[model samples]
Target chain A: MLNTEALAGVRYRENDVRVFEELVRRYDRKLYNVALRLTGNPDEAKDLAQEALLRAYRGFSRFQLGTSFEKWLFRIASNLYIDRLRKQRNVRFESLDEPVPTASGQVEKALPDWSNNPEDVAEQNELADEIQAALQSLPINYRLAVILYDLEGFSYEEISGILRCSIGTVRSRIHRGRRLLREKLAPYVKPAAAAGARW
Target chain B: MTCEKAMSLMSAYLDKELGFDEFRQVELHLAYCEACSQEYESLKATKELLGTLRAADLPREFWPELRERLGAVAAEERVAPARAKFASSARQSSSRQPRWRGILRPASGGGGGSLFSSPMAKALVPAFLVLVLAALPMVWSTRRRPAEAQVSSRIDSIEPYFRDYVISEYDRPLSDKTSVGFVVTGQAVTMYTSDLLGPSSKVTRASGLREASPLPPNTAGNEYTLISYPR
Candidate 1:
């Protein structure tokens, strides 16, 4: 356990720059990952991570020592990502009633080539690609919960803090997200005979 | 518990957050239910597979910029207290030292006109009192000198005669008629539980003497030191 009392005393009273530097260095990578998964873009993740660090630095004085600094920092980063997403309200997804839009609503949707041409199907090689596509297509909230719990290994409590939701919601999102991924990946799951093919 | 309820708690059960009773309920349900067990396994595997996504560390220089920003913020915090102190000191010098105006006038350029203007000067009265509090001990000692000396002289003169008598009187049981003696010094009154042959004492309370009888009530600033009493 991080010595919250000592860290807080040093941070508030000593105003220790090195401690603050260590804090940023410690959380920056995790924060970047969170931002990356949330924004679904590297450049935006980097910007958001830097912004979160700055915000955390500004607000460090008010941070309660001995509590979850990780949660606090993630909350800041998550809120920033949510704010950015809110600002970009034009991010349109395929509504339940609408056809799946490819790249743009006007672009003709490309179906997966399944001619059993061997070269086109590529056996299990397309599984990873499909999973990634399905993940990108997930609603932002479900995607966030899936990434945080599945990829980041955040406890449900930590995810709740990061997502500003109850743990029940986090569990529901994860369960729903996985169910959706399994559904989307259904066609791609190769049969035992088909699995023998070379990539 | 039904499988539905048990499933609702699986996450908490996995995390060991469920209470013992709930844990028992979930455990009993899980033992009987295969479908829920399969769902739990899938959820656990998905959690594991998700955990495999390594967080990509940014370039080495990224944290440096963040640290630099943090350092700047920390430096700002360090300077805040000193800045506040300086501001207060400047405010003090402006009000107390008329001669400081000459120095401030040239510096202020045109902002000096409102320095001594209404409301601000009135506010200076409280600030001036605070500055004077630095010499509070001296003020209290000077005011208390005469009464303190009288008490000391009375103690000295009365000591020789009361030596054995004071000792015998202290032997008289702790009672209401004990007649605790006190000397009024400035705004304070000094009292002793018995009197000198023991140690000097002070009994203070904020409510004047309303409760200053032999028995003391809960009050602020009421403290006693045994002056001197018989052995």
Candidate 2:
């Protein structure tokens, strides 16, 4: 199998759609998962992942050969995600504050129910939901840092490149993000640890 | 190391990203300080829990759908150059005659002979003419309006900076028929000028403006400046 750079080179030099398709096959699942974790919405995740790939194809000519294609691709994805967030910021703010019309009457909108009892978080699926909710609750930058570092397993340097921040900033964000996560998931952490030490 | 210091380095320590001395310090601290050790364990546990969350695979039909979309995109890209050629030919013809006339002339074998020779082009001329005629009045009225006439009230305050230039946030052609606009938000001024200046046009210090940095390249538009002026 050709390495990513070599594949990218073939696609770039030969304009081979087959090689590009191969690249898409390799990355679609991982990209889709990352988008899912970031947005916590499967539909949005699918759209974001597909859009990212389309953008990658459109901008393939600009990609420098010999550089990490993964990072370049991720940088595009992250930037698109950020742009979407910015565009949606006002709509999200307004929707959150606006009263939703119910059958009874228009009432004050309640925030998402993130607080779960320790007992309720016992199931793996429920635990995953809690973790995802906690992850989504974080500010965008910190959430991105944590997702890239811990979830996606990108190195700090690669993350800094993908996020377009300094390595020091990456380190700080990851540390702070983990601390925030630990606080939110405190109720389940101990029991899960006692269940079995997987790490 | 103080607990605060050791705890701050906990993530790096767990990730094996710390230097040898820093790693040693954190290890020694975690070994003795029960609180820090617990904190380290909790952080590690959180990461482990995150890892346990299985990645949801894309639906089975996702690749097929994406492949279809890619095929459509490829088809569009292939058509784009032919469209550009037709447009350029129309533009060249329009320089000598009316734009609508230039467009219709293609059917009469004026330019882009291959493109306009199609049966679809024969049907398009009359429909396009009707549309253009309907839109002509609005176009004429807009063209007659002064370039600076619709400048926003907000831009009036900064009018002194470039009295000669008509500055508007909205996309409007300059008096010279070039699209130019400058947005001043707080201290930063972003100038987006299409056709008037190339993408690489830089702001000289002599222009009483300090170039801060170029913003990230926008995919849809030309790159512009994020500059500030010395008040």
Candidate 3:
């Protein structure tokens, strides 16, 4: 169809170095922000994003135009951060997101009903700080999965490619990561005003 | 599904990565289970709250700094492959010539008025040439290291690695239908540089050699190992 974004993709693939700046301009800010949040260091985030772009440039010819460039870029950038995290060994690897039985045949989180009022979860600004802190506390695998799923709104399939793991793993990481975040931020949440406030 | 199952699937429900059966079970349970419903709400709230933590307020220096760095990287990328290519070509030219004669004649009693009549004359000529060939790569590497380093300052940047390159040239009379001359040497330094270092580092890098480049294991000072490829 020769759409504009495709043309840009094609231009990029053709070694049109000029087009590189435009792609960088278009994506660098957004990518840099995500990387900063992921790595929790602005300087590291900048380097991460820059490395991703450099890699993307080198491999652009292999990138097909019909697919999503944003996803491709994120896959590269997120994977770099993921690889770095894996190296530090601070991230404890967890299970697949699938429901599973223990050797004792008991599935964790099988019966679920636990709730308290959370609408007064503090002001947005206050909550934002707490959430960031909470995110920083979780292991890198969980953190990346949860943030990519919730904050960035990527699908399980997309995240699988980004993480280079099975979809089951993505699900598990998101759940576990979110569990850790809730545990960290639970103190900041206000008591329920009413029984039916649900949220 | 029990409350445990429903709870386990809560993230899947939120993410929509669940299968239909599992999705329906979680949803049906959420409607009836007050606790699970409320928990879901809180999780949802957390997701929403994080959305507010938008892009950091970048310093005015961020973009300028990034742009300048990218420009430098771009310039390096443009030049590195060309230099690597030139190096490869120079090495190839040296390799195409016969070297066995150099080795054999050094010890042979070909002492004559032709070139090697006196012992001093014979010894000095080979010794001097050996000095040049030995020093050639070291000098070449020293001159080239700074520039190569400039291109791939970052560890992960695509520095091109060249390895086990074989170059051949044959000169045959028009009357002869058969191949005449060939030179193949086993010991050669291989260099591995990622493609990003230069404009055509990847494209121009020689590939499909019979052997995987068993180059220097460490790429520190990509110059020293690569400079030897020409010899």
Q: Indicate the residue-level lDDT of B173 in model 1.
A: 68
Which of 1 and 2 is ahead in lDDT?
2
User: lDDT of model 2 at residue A60?
Assistant: 78
| Docking quality category of candidate 1 according to DockQ thresholds | incorrect
lDDT per residue as tens, model 1, B130-150: 879978998998998897667
Off by over 4 Å in 3: A1-17, A58-68, A83-125, A190-199, B57-59, B98-231
Please list the residue runs of candidate 2 whose C-alpha ends up more than 4 Å from where it truly belongs after superposition.
Answer: A1-15, A92-124, A191-199, B85-231
In angstroms and one decimal each, the interface RMSD of every candidate reads 5.9, 3.2, 3.2
Encode model 2's per-residue lDDT on A31-94: one tens digit a residue: 9988999999998998898888888887777987767778888889899999999999778355
Highest DockQ: which candidate?
Answer: 2
- In terms of TM-score, the best-performing candidate is 2
| Model 3 lDDT per residue over A76-192, tens place | 987788788778787675654556768888575554435353444444446566677788888878888887777767789988887789998998888888777767877754435
Candidate 2 docking: what grade?
A: acceptable
Worst 10 residues of 1 chain A by lDDT: A190-199
TM-score of chain B of each: 0.39, 0.39, 0.40
Q: Give TM-scores of chain A for all candidates.
A: 0.68, 0.77, 0.65
lDDT of 1 by residue, A1-199 (tens): 5455655656555557677666456677777877876766678788898888788767777888777888888888877877877887887756444456566565455556657586666654364445556777788889888877766768888888877899778877776787676567556433233211211
Minimum summed lDDT over a 10-residue window in model 2 chain A is located at A190-199
- Models 1 onward score TM values of 0.51, 0.58, 0.54
